[model samples]
Target: MDFRAINTIVFAFLITMCSFGQINCNCSIGSYLEKIELLNTRDSLEVFELSAELKKTKLEVCKFKALEIEFNYFITQLNEEKAFAVLNELEDYLGRINCESDLKFNIYINKAKYFKLHNNYEKLSEFAFKALKEAEYLKDSNKEIEAIKQIVYLFTRMDEDDKNWQYIKRAEKLIFKQSNPIRSVKNFRWLAFEYETKYTRTKRKPLLDSLFIFANHSKKGAKKYNIFDELALSYRALEAYSYHKGNAKNALKYIDSAIFYAKKIKGKKNLSGLYISKAWDHLDWGEKELAVKWMDTSFAYDTKDDIAGFMMHHLDATDLYEQAGRLDKALSSYQIHSRIKDSIFNTERTQVINELETKYKTELKDAKIKRLNVLLVITLLIIVSILLAGSVIQLKRTRKKNKILKRAIEEQERLEKELSDVRGEIAQDFHDDLGNKLARISLLSSLISGEVSIKSPNIKSKIKQINEDANGLYKGTRDFIFSLKSNSDYLEEVVTYLSDFGGDIFNKTEIKFTVEKHISTNVKLPYYWSKQIVFIFKEALTNAMKHSNCHTVKLSFGYQGYQLSIRCEDDGIGILESDLQSLNGLSHMKTRGIKIGCELLINSNIGEGTAVILKGNLKEDII
Candidate 1:
C-alpha cells in the first residue's frame, strides 16, 4: 500500500479509539460539551452520531448543549433547516432552564448566528441587539465586543458598507480602550478580516489601509501572547492587503511567514483552511495551476477521518483540478466527495424525518398521520435528489447551491400557508362582491314594487314576481356565505340554517315552519357538505312556498347508527306520484344531494302532502 493509504488507516484507527473513549463518557453537562467539541476535532459528520447519543441522554442541560453544538454544525454545513431545528430546541430549552444572563447571552448569540446564516437580517438584528444589551448588563468587554462584531458581520454580509464600517469603528475604539488589548487579539483579526472582506467588495483604498492597521494590531497581540493561530491569521490578512495593493513579492513573503507560524501548531490543520481559501482566490484569479497546487496541499493536511473536512476540501479540490485540466484527479476526488455528500444527505434526511414524525405524533394522534410521514419522507427524498442533481459532479458549494436540502419542505410549508390564505381571501371577496350586488338588486325590486306604478295589470303582476325572485336570490346568497365561513363539523348547524331560510320564505304567509332535531350524536360533515346540504334544503323550502301551497312545513335532522337523515316535509295540495319526479325544484335538489353522497326521495299524493327526505352514510362522508 501507498504511504497515504497507510496514513489514512492509522488516522481512522486513532479516531475510532478516541470516539470509543468519548462514547462512554459519564453522563454530565461537561461530557456533552466535550463530545460536541469533537465536531471541531474529529469530524463534522461525528455531529450526527454524537447528537444521536445526546438525544438519548436524560439530562436537559446536556441536550441543550448538544443542540447548541449541532446548531454550529448545521450553520457551518449550510443546512439551514437543521440549524433552524437546533435553534428552536435550544430556545425552548433555554426558557425551561431559565438560564442566567450569561447563558442567555450565549443563546442569543447562537440565535443571531443562525439568522445570519439563513440571511434573515430582521431576526439577526433582533437577537444581535439583544446580545449587545446582555453584554452591557454583564459588563463584559469581551462579550460586548463579540456582540458588536456579530452586528458588524451582519452589515458586512448585507453589503451595507456604511453600517458595517460604523460598527467596526465602534468595536475598534472599545477594544483599544482596554488595558491589555491582548484579550481582543482574535477580535482585531476578525475586524481585519471584515475590513479585508469590505475591501474586496468595494475595492476602496481606505478599507485596504484600515485592514493593515487591524492586522498589525492583531499581530502585536499575537506576539505578546504567543497565540500562534492569531499570529498566522494576522500574516494572512497582511498577505491579502499586500496582494490587493499589487505588491505580489511582499504578499508572498507574508504568506510564507503565515505558513511558518501555522505549521508550528495543530499539525497544519488550520493551514489547510487557509490554503483552500487562497486556492479558491487564485482559481477565481485564473491561476489554475497555483490553485491546484494549493488545493492538493490543503487536501494533504485535511484529516481523511474527518469526513466533513475531507469532503469539503475534496469537493473544492475537484473544482480546482477540473479547472486545471487534471481530469483524472478531478474525477477521483469528485467520486469520493459525491459518496460522502450522499451519505450526509441521507443521514440528515432520516434525522429530519424522525424529528418531524416525533413532533407530529406528539401533537396529532392518528394512524393517518403516520401514513403521511411515509409520504413526507418519500417526497423529501425525491426533491432533494432532483435539486441536488449532477452538480455533485462539480461539487462546489455556492450559496445559491447550498440552500439546504430541507428547502423543499420549507417551500412546501410556505405554499400551503399561502394557499390557505388565498382561499380565505377569495371566499371573503366572493361573499362581499356578490352579496352586495344581490342585496342591491333586491332593494331595487322592493323600491319598484312600492314606488313605481304600472298601468297594465300584467306588468304589475310581473313586477311582484321580480321582487320575490330578487328576495329569494338575496337570501340564498347570505346562506351560501354563512356556510362558506362556518367551521362547524356538525350537521345540526346546517339544519338550523335551513329552518331559518324556511321561516324567511314563508314570512307574512299562512304557513307554519318548524325545525326538529332527533340526532343522538354529532354527525360530522365536511365543509363542502354544509353548502350542498343547505342549498338542497333551500330549494325544497322555495318549492314548498311557491308551488306546494303548503300551510305547514317541517325540517327535521336525525342520525341513526352511522347514517345521516334529513327531511323537508310540507302539508299542501300535493302532486301526483308521476309529477313528484317531474317537479322543477326536485331535479336541482337531487343534483346537489348527489354531491354529498345522499339519495333524495320525493313522496307526494294528490291531496295529502309532499316530503323530501335525504339519506346518506355519515361514516363514509366523515372519512
Candidate 2:
C-alpha cells in the first residue's frame, strides 16, 4: 500500500481506540488497541467523530493517552508540523495534569520519537535519557528497555560505536530482568544492525559472525511476538552482511525475504530500504540495467520528506547512471544531489540565524520590561519621600506652636505667683507693725485711765473708752492680716487658721470657744470664699462676746459631697428680731457671703442664743 493509505488506516485505528475503547465495552487500552488493529480502517468522518467523542470523556488519563496516540498518528503520516503541534499540547498539559510515572514515561518516549523522525539526534538523545530516568523511577523494566534501545539507536546513527555499545549492554542488563518479547526483538535488531555496519566497514570475519548471530536472535523473538517490522530489519542486516562477504547468492536470498515481510506492512518505509539493498546486489552482480531499475523503484518508494534520504537516493542513482554510460542522466542526478545537499546546509544556517534573532529580541524585551519596572519603583519612592517630607514639616510647625503656648502659660503663672507673694508680704507687715503699735497705744490709755480715775473722773472715763477702741482696732487689724496673708486654696489651712483666731480672741474671756472640724483635708476652697467664711465667723463671735453674755461659743466646719458649711452659735442673751436690722456687723457678713457665693442665715430668739450658718458649694466656687 501507498504511504497515504497506510497513514489513514493508522489515524483511523487511533481515533477508534481513543473514542469507543472504554466507553462502549469498558475495555482496557491493550484490548482496545488489539480490537482496532483487527478491524478495517475507518474513514475521515469516523475519525472526526472519534476525536469529538474522546474530548467528551472526563478522565484526564484518557485525554492524555488520546493526545499521545494522535501525536504518533501524525508521526506515522509523516506530518511533522502537526506532530510538533500535538507535542506542544502534551507538554502544556504535563504542567497542568498530575500524571503517574508510567504516563510520564510514555510522554517522554513520544517526544523522543518526534526528534528521531526529524533527525534531531541531540534532542532525541536528551528525551531518550529523560524517558530512561522516568522508566527507572516507575520501575518498569519494559519502558527502560525501550528507552535504552532508543539511546543505542541514536548513538549508532551518530557513528559513536563506543557509546552505542555502552547503551546496548545497559539494555541487555534490563532485558534479562524483564520479559517483553517486542522489546527483546528491538534490542536484538539494533545489535544486529550495529555488527553488520561494523563488519562492512572493517571487512572482518569475526564481526560478520557476530552480526549473523544477533540477526538470528532477533528473528527468534520477532517470530515469537509476530513483529514483522523487526523481522524485516533483521533480514536487511543479514543481507548487508552477506553482500559484504561477496556472497551474492546469499545476499539476494536475504533481500527477497526482507521485501516479502516488508510488503506485508503499509507505506513500504522499510521496503524502500530493502529495494536499495537489492539495487546494491544487482550492481555487485554487474547487471547494470537491473541495478538502474531497482534504484528507480527505491526512489519511487522514498516518499517521506527527508532531505538526507532524497540525497542518498540521488547519489546512488548518479553512480548507477554513470556505470550505465548514461552521461546526461549521471550529470543531472549529481547536480540534483548537490543542490539538495546545499539546501540542507542552508536550511541549518537559516535555523541558526532565526534562533539568534529570537534570542536577541527576547533579551531586548526583557531589558525594556526591567527598565520600566525600575522607573515605576523610582516614581513610587519619590511620591513617598514627598509625603514624608510634608509630614515632617507639618510636625515641626505644630511643635513650634505648642512651644510658644507653653511658654506663655509659664510666664502667666510666674507673674500671678509674684503678685500673691507681694500681697502676703504686705499683710505680714500690716499685722506685725500696725497691730503691735495699736496694742501699745491701748496699754498706755489703760494706764492713764487707772492713774486719773479719782482725781479726774471724766478724763479717766474718756481714756478708758479710748483704750477699748484701740483694743478693738488691734483685733480687727490682726483678723484682716490673717485673711489676707494666706490663700484659701487649701480647706484645711483656712479652717485651722479660723479656729486658731477664735481661740486667741476668746483666750482671756469667760466664753469657752470650741472649734469642731469634720472636713477632709483634701477639700479645696476658693480664696474669696475662705475670707468671707472667716469674716462671718468673726462677726458672730464678736457680737456674742460684746452683747450676748454667752458662756460658750461653738464654731464648726464641715463638708459633704461638694458642699462646705461653716457655723457659729453661742448660748447668750438672744437678740430681738426687730434689732437684727440695727446690727451693721450682721449686715456686712451677709453681704460678704453673697459676694462669695455662700448662703448666709441668722437665727435668734429672746431667750435662745444666736447662730450664724454659712453654706457654700465648693465646686461652684471653683468653676
Candidate 3:
C-alpha cells in the first residue's frame, strides 16, 4: 500500500536472493572438494564418471578445471616412501593423457620429487633439469626456482658436492638481493642444504656454520604442505651423510625420521623400492632373517619389469640358498640366469640370420630356374642349327640342278623360236598356193558333176570326196599355227587361256566350272614350261569334265614366291587307289610335271572327288 513499504520489501527480496546465490556457490565448492578426494584416493574411474555427469549438467568448464586440480592433489598425496611407485604411475598417466601447461608443470615437479625420494640421483638430476627447461618455456619464475632447488638437492645426493654448491650459490646470487623476502628465504634454505649436506661431508666447519645461518633464515618461507616429501628426502640425505661419516647410530636415527615422513605420504608403486632399501639397512645391521623377510615383501609389491631389481633379488636368493647349503636351489637359480642370458643371445642371432636365410632361399630358387632356362635355350639352338644345316645342303644341290636346267631351257627356246618361224612360213605357203589350187579343183568338180548327169555318178562321188579332204587339210594347218603362237605368252596368260578353254569344255558337259585368278603377270616361266603347265591343267580339267561326270569343278591358281600352283577339284565318282596307280592319264600328268620341274599331287578316294595340284618354280630365263 505505501511506497516506503514497497521499497523495503524490494530491498529484503534482493538480500534474500544474494544469500541463496552464496549458498549455491558453497555447494559447488563442496562438490569440487569431493571430486578432489576421489582423485587423491586413486579413484580415477569414479572421477571420470563424475566428470561425465558434470558435462551433462552444464558444468563442463568447471568439471574440466576440477580434473586438472584433482591431478595436482593426487600428486600431493603420494608420499616420499612411495615416491618411485607414484612416479611410475604418473609417467604412465601422462603417457595416456593430453594435459595442458599448468597440469604438465605440476606432473613434472611430482616426478622430480619421486626420483629424489628414491635417492635415484641420476634420474632425479635428469628430471629436475628437464623441469627447469619446461619452467623456462612457461616463464614461471616460481617453478624455475623449485626446479633449481630440486636439481641442487639431486646433485648433493649424487655426491657432486661442488656442482651442488655451485647451483645453490647461483640461486643465492639471483634471489638474495630481491625485494621479495619469501623468495630470498627459500633460496637461502636451498643454499644451506647444499653446503650442510653436500659440502659439510668433508668436515668444513665454516661452510657448516654458513649453512646453519641460512637455514635459520629460510624457516619462514619453507612452511608449505607440499614440501613434506622434500623434507623427508632431506632427512634421508642426512642419514646417508651420517653413514658416510661412520656414525651408524646417528644415521639410523635420521633414517627413522626419514621413514616417518616417507610413510605419512607414501605412494602405491614406490613402497617396493623403499622396502628393499630398508632390507639392505637391516642386512647391514646383521639382521639376516629380517632382511630376507623385508626382501620377500618388496618382491611381492614389485609389479614392474625392472631388470636391476630382478637381478638383485636373484643374487640375494642365490647367496642365501648357497650359504644354507641347498645346492639344488642354488643350481636352479643359476640355471634361470643362464637361460635368460642364452635366450637374449639366441634372439639376436635369430634376427640376424632370418633375413639372410630368406635372401638365400630366394636366390637359390632363382638360380635353379636360370639354369633350366639356359639348358632349354641350348637345346632349341641345337635343333635350329641342325635344321639350318640340312636346308643349306639341299639348297646347294638345288642351285646346281637349276644351272643345268637353265642351259637346257635356253637351247630349247632357240629351237622353238626357229620352229615357230618355219611353221608361220609353211602356213602362209599352204594358204596362198595349195589353198587356191584346192579351191579351183573344188569349183571344177562341181561343174563336171553338173555336166555328167546320170551316166557317171560313181566318178562324181569320188571327185566330191577329194574336195572335202582338201578342206580338212587347210583346217589342220591353221590349228598348228595357233598352237605355236599360244606358247609365246607369259604363264599368267597361259593360265587365263586354259581356264577359258576349260570353262567351254565344262559348259559342253553341263558341269559348273569356277575359275579363280591364280598367277600374276609378274610371274615368269620359259615358253616351253608355260606351255607344258597349261597343257597339264587343260588335261586335268578335260578329264574331270568328260570322264569324272562331275557336277561342280573348282580351278584355282596362285603364285607364292618363285612357285606357281594350280589346283583342280571336281565332285565326281573318284578313282580307286588301284586305278590311280595304273591310270595312263595320271602317269602322263606325272611325266609332264617332271619335265617342267613341278610337283603334281593327286588326291582321290572312292567317294571324294579328284584334286590335282601342280606346283612349280618359274624359270629364270623367262624373268
Q: Which prediction has the highest lDDT against the true structure?
A: 2
Which prediction has the highest TM-score against the true structure? Answer: 2
User: Candidate 3, clashing residue pairs?
Assistant: 79-265, 79-266, 85-269, 85-270, 518-557
- Residue 539: error of model 3 in Å? 99
Model 2: per-residue Cα lDDT at residue 9: 55
Which scores greater on TM-score, model 1 or model 3? 1
TM-scores of the models, in the given order? Answer: 0.35, 0.44, 0.28
lDDT of 2 at 218: 84
Residue 229, model 2: lDDT of 73
**Could you arrange the candidates by lDDT from highest to lowest?**
2, 1, 3
Higher-lDDT candidate of 1 and 2: 2
**Colliding residue pairs in candidate 2:** none
lDDT of 3 by residue, 1-623 (tens): 46566456555655765765543221154365444433323344544565556545543334444444444434444445444554455555544433334446666676766654444444555567667766766666667778778866544333456666666776666666566554555466556556655553677657655665665455434334233444455555555455544555665676666567656653443445445545555555666766667666766766534433354455555665455455675577667655544533344544443343345346556766886786575555556555878899989999999999999999999997898787667767766787677677777877777777677779878877876776666544443434456343466666667777777677766788898875555565665675566667777987897788778999998876677888999999998889988999888988989997889999998677999999877655657
lDDT of 3 at 209: 59
RMSD of each: 28.5, 33.9, 39.1
How well is each residue in 1-623 modelled by candidate 1, as lDDT tens digits? 66566456555655765765544323455455434422442235566578778777776555666677678776765667887887777777777754443378878898888776655555666677778767766777767887887777655434457767777877878887776455567777888888887787778899889889989998997887677778999999998888788776677678778888877653215458678766655665678888788888887666454455566677777877888888998999999988976764454544543354345335444545775875585555556554666466446655445676468779988995786576567668877898677778777767776776666667667777887887777676676666656343457677667777777768878899888889876666865888888878888888888887878999888888887888989989888878766767778888888987889898888778889899988666463
All models: lDDT? Answer: 0.72, 0.74, 0.62
